[model samples]
Target chain A: MVAPVFDSGSFRDPDGHVFFYENEIYRTLTTDAVHRMERLLKLSFVKKSIIEGRIIDTKILEATKIFPKDFLVTEYVLWHEKIPYVTYPFEWTFSMLKDAAYLMLDLLSGLLENNFILKDGTAWNICFYNGKPCFYDILSIDTYVEGQPWEGFSQFLQEFLYPLMIQSYQGIDFQPLWRSTLAGIPAKLCYKSLSRSSLFKKGVFKYVYLQEKLSSNKTISEATLKHEFTHNAFSKKALTNLIKNLRLCLETLTVKSDQSVWKNYDSKNSYEEQDVKEKEKFVVEGLKALNPLSVMDLGCNTGRYSLIAADIAPVISCDLDPTCVDQIYLKKNSKILPVVLNLMTPTSSMGWHLNERKDIFTRVKSDSFMALALMHHLCISHNVPLSHFILLLRSIASKGIVEWVDKSDPMVQFLLRNRKDIFKEYTWENFQHLIREHFHIEKTLPLNNGVRQIMLLSEKKN
Target chain B: MNVLMYCLPLMATSTPCCAYLDAGSSSMLLQLLFGGVAGGLVFLKIYFRRLVSFFKAKK
Candidate 1:
C-alpha cells in the first residue's frame, strides 16, 4: 500500500495534521489534541453546529487502521467530508469575503456563549460550501478561561476587518495584495494607507486609529504587559457587545464598483434578442449533452451561462471584473461559486518555502470548461497566441466549449481600434486548425450574428 | 524593604521580555476595556427606554 501523503497546508497546527490515503482525507490528532477532541465532542453546540451545516462533519477513525499499530503515536484519527472546491481569500469577491467575516463572527459569538473560544482567527480556516461559509477546523475551539482576552481578536482585524475597511474606504481592490502577502494586509499598513477624512468614519477611530497606536507602543514595562493579559477580566456582556459592534461595523461597509463595463455586459452587447436566445439555446444543449460532474466557467461575466449550467452540475464562475463576480455572488446561487480572477496573472504558489499554497490551476481543474466570448480578450488584448490558448484549455479540462470571434466582428474591431493590427493570423480558419490539433471537434454552431461561432471539443486520445 | 530588595535582583537578572504573545494581544487588551464601557451604556439605554414605555402605559 502507498504511504499516506500529508497535506502541505496542514502543518501549521502542532496538534494535528491532515493526510490523504486511498484518496480519502483524514486528520491524525496528537495526544494533546485527543483530550481536547474528547471534551469538545461532548458539547451540544458542536453537534448542533455540524447538523446545521455551520461546521464540517467529522467521524473518528480507529488509529490502528490508519497507521501501522507499532508506529501509532496518537490515540485518535478523524475523517472529514471533502469540500467540492476549495477557494482562497484572494480569489473571493468583496461580498464573498464579507460573508466569510460575518460567518466567523457568528461562530465566535456562539462558541463564547457555550464557554468556548477560537484559538486564532485566520480567513484560511473558513471554506465556502453550498454557497455559505463554514468553519472547518475542529481543533480551533477550546474552553474559555476566565479573564483571558479574546485571543483571536487582533488576527480577525488583520485578516478580515482591515482588508474590508481599506476596500470600502479607498476603493482599491485588495485581492492582489492578499494573494501576494497570504498573511493578510497588516493593520498598521492599512491605517497608513487610508485618507485623513476616512479616519473620521464611525468605527475607524476605535478599531483603526486606536489599534494602530496601541500596537506600535513599545515603551511599556514587562510587568504592565503581564498585568494586561493576566489581570484583565472580560465580562460575558462585554464580549457580547464586542461581537455585536463588530457585526454592525461590517454590515455598514458597502462598496459598489464604479467601473461597470462587465456589470452591464449583457445589456451593453450588440447582440440582438434573437442572437442571445440562439446562443443560450446552444450552450444549454451542449452542457446537457456533456453532463459533467462540475463545470468551470472562465471569464464568467455576471454568470449568465453559469446560472443555467448550475441546474445540471456545480459551477465555478470566474471573471476578472470584481463587480461582475460580486453580482454573481450576491445572487445567492447555491450551486455556483463566484470568484474574481484575472487569467492573465492568476494566483501562484506563495508563503513559507513557496509551497504552502498551490497555484490556481493546480487547485481547481474541472472535467468541463466554458470559455464564452473570451477568445479575443486573450489573443488581441493580452497578445496570447491562439495555439497557446488552446493548449491551456486542453491542460485544464478534458472537454470544453469555446467561442471564436472572427476579426471581422465589431467587438474584435473595437479591440483593434487604437492598437496596431499585428494579429494577422487571428482568423476563424487558423483558429479551427490550431484547436483541432489538440481536440476532436464534436459540434459547431453559429449565433444569429454571423461574425461569431461556437465549437464543442473533446481532447484527443494519445 | 526586604521584599523590594528580593524582587529587584530577580527583575534585573530576568531576560528581556519577549514572551511570545501573538501579534494582536495588545489590541485585544484595549478592546476589552473599551467594550466594557460600551456594553454598559447599551444596557442602560435599553432599560431607560423600557421605563419610559411603562409610564406612558400607566397614563
Candidate 2:
C-alpha cells in the first residue's frame, strides 16, 4: 500500500484525488478534471509544447478498473517519473528560483506563440528533474484567446516575480513568506512589506511598484482600472518591454547567504587525517562494489560519503538537517538531489486525500545504499530492534554498505555514559546474525578506528 | 553568465520586450547590452576574487 507523507497545501478538486502509486504516480481525474483534460488535449499548443520540452509528457494510464468509492473519473494520468523528493519553492536558492521563473515565462511565451496560455504560474507547478526545471502539471495548460487579458498575471507576479524580487532587491528572506501562505505570498503583502529602496533600484523600480500597483486595490475600484486600460493600450513593443523588464530583474537577482553548513563540514568533522583517509578508502571501495545506478546515503552529513558515490551514479543524499541539504545542493548545483529527511520518520507519500506525495519506500528502490555510522543512532538513540533495522534496510535497498558500531566503542559509550544501555541486542554478533538472515555478507572491512566497521551485503542468499 | 540567464525572466516580467533577448529586454537593445556587460562583470568579480586572494597569500 502507498503510505501517506505530506498532505498540506493540496489543491481541492472533485476528482478522485492524486496518489503516489509504486514507481509510477497516478492522479485520478474526477468528471470535472476529465472534462478539462479533454479540452486541454485538443489545443495545438499543448501538442507543440509536449513535442518540445516546454511541458512534461501526460500519458493516460490503461487501467480499466477503479479504486474503491469510484471517487475518480473515467480517466487518470499515470505519471511515470515524479521528482525523487519534493522540494517546496522556499527551499530553492535565488538563482534556482530565478531559473524556474524564466522557464515558466519562456514556456508561457511559447504557449502564446502557439495560441495557448497557462492557467497558472505558480513555482510549485515546476519541478527540477535532471539538471533543469520541467513543467509537470498538465492541468495548468489551456487555450488562450487573443483578445482576452492575461488572467494569471497577478499570480505570476505573486508566485514567481514578487518572491524573487523580495529576495533580490529588498534583501528580505522569502522562506517565512512561503511557509505562511500556501496560495503563494499575496501581492498586496509584497507591495506593503518591501522596502522603498526596492522600488528605486535602477531596473527593479518599474517592476516592484508598477506590477504591484496593477494587482492591488481590487475592492477599491479606483482609477487603477483606467491605468490598466492605458497600460494595456501599449503596443506589442511596450507589452513585450514589460515582459522584458521583469525578465531582466529576475536574471540579476541573487541570494547571497553564507549560512551553508557543508562549506565547513570537513573542518568540523574532527576526523584525524589518517582516520579520514581510511574512511574515504572504505567508502569508495564499498561504492565500487555496489556499482549502483542510484544510491541513497542515510545521515549523509555534508555528503562526505554521498559525493563519493555520486562520482559513480546519481545520488540522493539525505540528512535530518536542512542546513546540510542546502549546502550540499549549492555545491553540487542539483547534480545530487539533497533532501531533508529524518530516517526515524521519513517523508511518506501523502497528497490530495492522502496520495499525491510518494512515501520513502515507494519513491526509491536504490540499487545501493550506505548507512555509515548510522545503525548505532537507530538502535541506541531511536531504540529500533536489530531485526527491524535489517528488514527496513533490505526493503529500501537490495544491497547496502552498512556500518555496525559495537557498544564498547567510545561513541557508543558516550551515548551510554549517562543512560543505561538497554540495547543488549545491539552487539556486533547480534547485528551480523540478523543481517545474515536477510542478506549475504559479501565483505567486511574493519577500520583502524574502533568506533565503526563496514560490511557489504547483498540479497543473493539470505 | 548564470546571473544574466537567471535575471532574464525578472527583467521580462514588467517589460515583456526583454523576454525575447537572451541578453536582457528586447525593447532597449542598448540597455540589454549594458545589463549583459554588468552581469558578466559580476561573474568575473566572483570568479577572480578567490584567485586574487590566492596570489596575495603567495606574495
Candidate 3:
C-alpha cells in the first residue's frame, strides 16, 4: 500500500505509465494496451466521445485494488480525471492552439469513423479540460492498421499542423516557438519560416510544400516503402477523403492581430464608465472576500478583471499581450486560463533536468491575486522596483487585489512619456511604504476616477 | 532533374523498407496521394450538387 509515484511527464508512453496513488490519477495498462483498451471500451464512439466533451473520462481501476506490489505485471488500471491546471502546449493561447488543433482533428475524424487511429499526434496529447480541447490519451487509440499511413501523420504535422501553420503564416508568436521546441514547429522549421507569399497559400502547396518535399526525399523506395505498407489499401473513401482534406486544411487557418500594445486596452483606457463600474465593483468585492480556489489574473488586459475573477475562482489569466492573450483565448472560458505571461519576463526553469519544464512561477501559483492595470507596467514600464514589486506580488498571492497607478496617472503619465522619471520611489507614499512591507492592507478602494487605487492585500502573518 | 534521375534508378533497385517507415511514412504516403485526389474531387462536387437537386425536385 505505498508505491505508485511515476508521472515525471508519464515516462514517454510505452503504452501506459501515469501514476500517483493516494491522490488518484492512475493508468497502468501495457499488456500491449490491453487489446486497445478493450477495443476502445466497446466503442459506441467511446460513449459518444465521453458524452461529447471529446473524451477523457476513463474509469476501470482494480489493478489488484490499486497497485498491489506495483501493478503486479499490470494489464489495465486507468482512472484519470485530474486536469485542473496542467497547461502546456507552451501555455496555449492562439485560440488555445487553435482549439488544440481542432481537438486533434476532431479526435482524428472521430477515430476515423470508428475503426480507430491516433497512435500519437502529441501536442502533449491535448489537455485544457473545462475550457474545452480534451483528448487525454486513452492509450492513443489504435486499431486502424490497413495500409498504415496515418500513423499520426508525422505527429500531426509536427504537433498540430506545423504549430498552426507557423502561427497562421508567420505572424510568429507560437509562444516563443512552443517554448523552445518540445518537438513541434519543425516541418523543416516550418519550411524555413515561410513567406514567398506564404508559399502560395491554400493548403500551402499540399500541407507545407508537399510535406517539405516528402520530408527531404532520400531517394524514397524501400520497395516503394514496402509497397506502401503491404500493398496499400486505404479506402474508407480514402480515409474519409483524408479526413475531409484535413478538415479543409484546418479550416483555412487564420491569425491577423498584429499591432498590439494590449490590443486597444479596453477601448483606450482612462477608465470612467464610472471608472469601469468602479473597477468592476472592486473586483467583485475582492473576489467575494477571497473565496479563492485559485485566481491569478495579473495584467489580464482583455480579460477584464479576469472575467470578474472568473465568477469567483479558476482564473490564471496573466498577459503581456500576445494580443491580450489572443483576446482572452477567444473567450472559450472554461473559467479563464489565458496565459502569454511576461511579468517582466517569466517562464524560465526549462528542459532536461533543469527541472524538466516547470517555471512560470512554478506553473502558475495562486491562492488569489489580481494586480489589475499591473503597477504601472511593473513600476514604470519594467524597471521593477517598488520593493521589488512588492516582493513579486508577495510571491504571487496569499490573497491580493493590488492596482495602485499614480505617478499622476494618465496611465502613469503614459508610462512616463519618453522615460526619465527615474521613479523617485514612485510615490503614493512610496507605494504605501513598499506595500506595507509585504501586504496586510485589507481594503482601500478609490475608483470613481480619483486617479486610481484598489488595494485589498493580506499575507502578513510571519 | 528528371525527377532526380527517375528516383535514382528506383533507389538502386528497391527492397530496403521497414525501419518503422520513416519520414513520417513518406509524408503520409504523400498525404494519402494528395488527400485522396482532393477528396475525390470534393466527393464528386458533393454528390454532383445533390444530383442536381434531385432533378430540380422532379420538375
Candidate 2's DockQ is 0.02
Q: Give residue A234's lDDT in candidate 2 (0 to 100).
A: 27
lDDT of 3 by residue, A69-91 (tens): 64443656788787766667866
Task: Say which candidate scores most in lDDT.
Answer: 1
Query: Residues A1-462, candidate 2, lDDT per residue (tens digit)?
Result: 333321334454444345654445566565565666666666676667666655676765644553334333344553434566556565455555667789887777766665556776678787666545668776666666543334455566667777777766666666557645644566557767777666666454444453443223221111112232232332333334445676776777676555454546557543568877877887788778777778888878777777787778888777765555556666744457666666887655544546654565665557778888778778888899989988888888888788878887766776788897798777777787888887888888776465567788877652
The segments of candidate 2 whose C-alpha lies over 4 angstroms from its true place after superposition are A1-54, A57-95, A161-182, A186-218, A221-239, A273-278, A291-293, A301-304, A320-335, A342-351, A356-361, A364-367, A373-395, A404-441, A460-462, B1-59
> RMSD in angstroms, candidate 3?
16.9
**What DockQ results for candidate 1?**
0.11
Ranking by lDDT: 1, 3, 2
Find the 10 residues in a row with the least total lDDT in model 3 chain A.
Answer: A218-227
TM-score ranking, high to low: 1, 2, 3
Candidate 1: where are CA atoms >4 Å away?
A1-3, A65-73, A220-227, A257-259, B1-22, B36-59
Model 1 score (lDDT): 0.78
Q: For residues A1-462, could you state the per-residue lDDT of candidate 1 as single tens digits?
A: 335678888888888888876677788887777777777777787888888777888877777877765654356787888887788998888888898899888888888887888888889988888887888888787777765667778778888888888889888787887776787787678899899999888678667865665455432121133344344455666677778988999998989677557788778776779888888888888888887888999999999999988988899999998879888888898999887889899878877787888888888878999999998999999999999888888887888789998888888889999989999889889998998888888899887455889888876777
